[model samples]
Target: MTNKPDVSVLCFEGHKVRVLQLSGDPWFIAKDVCQALEIVNHRMALKALDHDEKGVNLTYTPGGQQLMRIVSESGFYKLIARSRKASTPNTFAHRFSNWVFREVIPSIRKHGAYGVPWALLHDFTRRSADSVERGSQAGKALVIRKIEKHQLAHEEKHLLDCFQPRLALGGESDAE
Candidate 1:
């Protein structure tokens, strides 16, 4: 059976970014994009298009002639959704931790921190709490060291909280 479309409505900045599927082509709507960036009018949205490394194409809004750039499906683009909390227990304390760290963190950093729900931070850090609480001094030091080395100072605290780190210790994994 075809799985139901995964959808999420995230309020970024002042906009409700609805991550939805339309015609099997996933799209985040234009109004939502503008809102996420806190651009009140079309001019600001157009200005932001120059920064789109993805060369995202735009579609006109009827009557307004304003365009919304869409990040089309491709190698780098992804669509994700939020689901209900799991009922059955799992070892992990978080759901989709990497995505939250990778995608949400940067966005939150770029935008002001006021609107995002604190629960997002909670969910992201939930899994790592045990590691933080129980790990040896060295282990905890490792977390701090990695944060200091890689992430920006502003991102350090959030990064440490949400860190799931699929990458292995010492920077190389055996599987690779």
Candidate 2:
């Protein structure tokens, strides 16, 4: 079994953030954390962490007041997305695929051929879409990967296949 760090909540610059500790387990107050950070909701929390550049800088408004929180899971999740978004999918895929392939896949491996099921993937994909709609480039590649992983053809071909039927119904060629 690979080493899995213990996840917990930590406070940085008055911001309630989650951390992965090597020792004992940690506690989390979802409501308290969200409120302290001044984020509109949990979705906002996910968005902020997803787009962080330098491991998420936690700054305070002079005299060390106010909050900006981030969670460890957010980092892991974003790593998956960043890996997917590079100039070539294969480049990032080789390095970061391990993030998902190592962490998530093993957790639900007991179900056999039907292991993990499509519902979970769908949930992740839906969240990926939400991240993209919220202008999260880190998650944009995740949405693309979600759809690409399921189709037998490449993205452009799949798009053509989808539009072909619509054009045929109107008795018009899709080339237009």
Local distance difference test, each candidate: 0.42, 0.42
Q: List the residue pairs that clash in candidate 2.
A: none
- In candidate 2, stretches whose alpha carbon ends up further than 4 angstroms from where it belongs are 1-19, 22-47, 50-71, 82-87, 92-95, 102-104, 108-176
Q: What tens-digit string does per-residue lDDT give for candidate 1 at 136-170?
A: 77787989998877767658767655664533442
Relative to the unseen true structure, what is the C-alpha lDDT of residue 54 in candidate 2, on a scale of 0 to 100? 16
Per-candidate Cα RMSD to the true structure, in Å, reads: 25.4, 22.7
Model 1 scores a TM of 0.25
Model 2 poorest ten-residue lDDT run: 53-62
Model 1 score (lDDT): 0.42
